[model samples]
Target: MARFCLPRDLYHGKGALAELKNLKGKKAMICVGGGSMKRFGFLQKAEEYLKEAGFEVQLYEGIEPDPSVETVMKGAAAMEAFQPDWIIAMGGGSPIDAAKAMWIKYE
Candidate 1:
C-alpha cells in the first residue's frame, strides 16, 4: 500500500505567515531558499511568530534552486540534529521541494 501524508492545517493569503503563532510544537525547523524571503522581511516575521508560539526554531537557509544531493543531505542532517517537531518550508518551490526531499531522507 502507498502512504501519503499532508499537513493537518494549511494557511494562506494576507498575514498567513502569522499563523505560525498558533502552531503547537516544541521545535520547528524552517527551510528557506535564497534572500527573497529575507529581503521582504517574511523570514524574520516567521521566526518571530514561531517564537511567539513557544517553539524553539532553527533555520536551514540557502536551499538552492532545484536543490542538489549534497544540499538535501545537509538539510536532512540538520533535521536529524535538530529533531524538530515541525518542518516549515518557506519561500518558493525550490525550498518546499527540497524540504519534502529532506523529510523523506530525515525519516
Candidate 2:
C-alpha cells in the first residue's frame, strides 16, 4: 500500500503569487529554477509576499531542467535544515516538480 499527500491550497494566474501573503506559517522555503524569475523580479516578489505573511523565508534556487537526483537530495537537505512549515515552488515545471519530490523526502 502507498499513501500520497498534496498541499491543501494552490494559487494560480496573474498576481496569484500575491496569495502567498495569506498563508499562515512561521517559516517557508521557496524552490526556484534558473534566473528568469529573478531577472523578471518574480522571485523578489515572492519573498516579499511570504514575508508579508509573517513567514521567515529561505530560498533554494537553480533547480535545473528535469532536475537530477542530487538536486532533489540537496533541496531535501535544505528543507530539513530550515524546518519550514510550508514549501513554495516558483517558476516553470522543473522547480515545481523537483519541489514535490523534495517535499516527499522532507516528510
Summarize candidate 2's per-residue lDDT along 1-107 as a digit string, tens digits.
99897777667789798888888989999999999989999999999998988999999999999999999999999999999998999888899899999999999
Across 15-96, the per-residue lDDT of candidate 1 in tens digits comes to 8998899889899999999999999999899999999999999999999999999999999999999999999998888998
Candidate of highest lDDT: 2
Candidate 1 ranges beyond 4 A from true positions: 1-10
| TM-score to native of every candidate shown | 0.91, 0.94
Off by over 4 Å in 2: none
